[model samples]
Target: MPHNLTKQPRRRHPQRSQYGLTLVELLVGIAIGLLLIVGATSLFLSNLDASRRLLLEARLNQNLRSAAELITRDLRRASYWDQAVPKMGSVDNNPHQGITLDGTSDISYQFDAPAGAASAAGFALTDDYRIRMTIGQTTQDLTDPAVAKVISFNIIESKNKIDIGMQKIPAATPNTECLTERRYDITIEAEAPSDANVKRRLETAVRVRNDRVGNCS
Candidate 1:
């Protein structure tokens, strides 16, 4: 028999293959995670700044309303039971007036009243003294260290605004109602925080409830 070598069946060997992520892929995944975290953090911080500004706006609005209403309440009762109205005119500016609606102004509410009952039955009536207070501006700079400043006061003149009025009350004695009613106007100009260009204004017409009838002194 020809020694033809019995060909041995070729043995099949499984090929060894490389597996798992490459170094490049691992580095890419880490980079992507870092990017995501940075983006998310940026968005959150921006939202927080916006919310703070809104809250600031709301508080400013409330403060303005409070100042307006408080002043009006006192003026509404002007002239009391009597119908005598008050005189309206701007005098020299004062910072403590507390009647101005604008952040800056100095003005006073003036009216005549009986000095006392000294001349009660006499021809001359009350001896009224003029009262004046300054209206100043209160400003806070949200930037920097967040400081507040009081700007100039008593800046506007009396003729710059509309005047309010009421009918004069008839003066009487003994049985007199003792109280008079007066009406007048106070003009206010406000400035909004954002866009310093936006202006918010408020004008209050008020009267003292117990306005006196003429000079009683």
Candidate 2:
């Protein structure tokens, strides 16, 4: 037999490569990634809200306490007339004329101003401060635009001892000999302008040192 010129075709194997993701697999992976992102975002928002609330609470408490302490100190010194001095009155052009015992929403009282004192030492009944205490021993406008807001400030006065739970009894008899006793129920409400929910209320009693005392001469 005559040999065929054409050689038999050699057998060849086709190589297989990795296949790409199917449509269903790609969609499932995208869905999982979205869920993770959503969860992370929610967690971050929750933490942020909690932190803001805490900061607001702290600010409210601080403002309330500071205002309370200052008011209390002033009340204790109310009507402080040196050991022997005529009671504050219309005479001598005395600006501070004892504590106003009316059930007013605000309180106004006069305290002895040290010799050579700049202005009379006193707090206006209105939250609008027309007078302020300075570290340099000076006075300034209390109602200045920069002043903080006082939502509510009230001074309730009582004579002798009242059994009311809101009362604060004095260590000594309010009135001794020629002295008269004046008890004060102080209530204050404060909040920042930005946040109404964050607020504070404080109530306390203070006894005036020389409310209506007289010299026994």
**Residue lDDT tens for model 2, 1-217:** 4457566777887866756888999999999999999999999999998787778667666665666677678767665555335533222322443665445554656665576342234444454522233323454433222323566767677866323222112324343223457887877666655566666677878877664533222
Listed in order, each prediction's TM-score against the native is 0.42, 0.62
Q: List the residue pairs that clash in candidate 2.
A: 129-142, 129-143, 130-142
Q: What TM-score number comes out for model 1?
A: 0.42
- For candidate 1, the lDDT comes to 0.38
Return the number of clashes found in candidate 2: 3
Residue 208, candidate 1: Cα error in Å is 7.8
lDDT of each: 0.38, 0.57
The sequence of per-residue lDDT tens digits that candidate 1 reaches over residues 1-217 is 4556766668988876866888999999999999999999999999997786666555544544555565566344322221132332222221212222333232233322244111101000011211122222322221111111111112222322212332223323322222234454644333334433333344666554443433222
Q: By summed lDDT, which 10 consecutive residues of candidate 1 come out lowest?
A: 117-126
Give RMSD to native, each candidate.
13.1, 8.9
Considering every candidate listed, which one attains the maximal TM-score? 2
After superposing candidate 1 on the true structure, give the runs of residues whose Cα lies further than 4 Å from its correct spot. Answer: 1-16, 77-104, 110-217
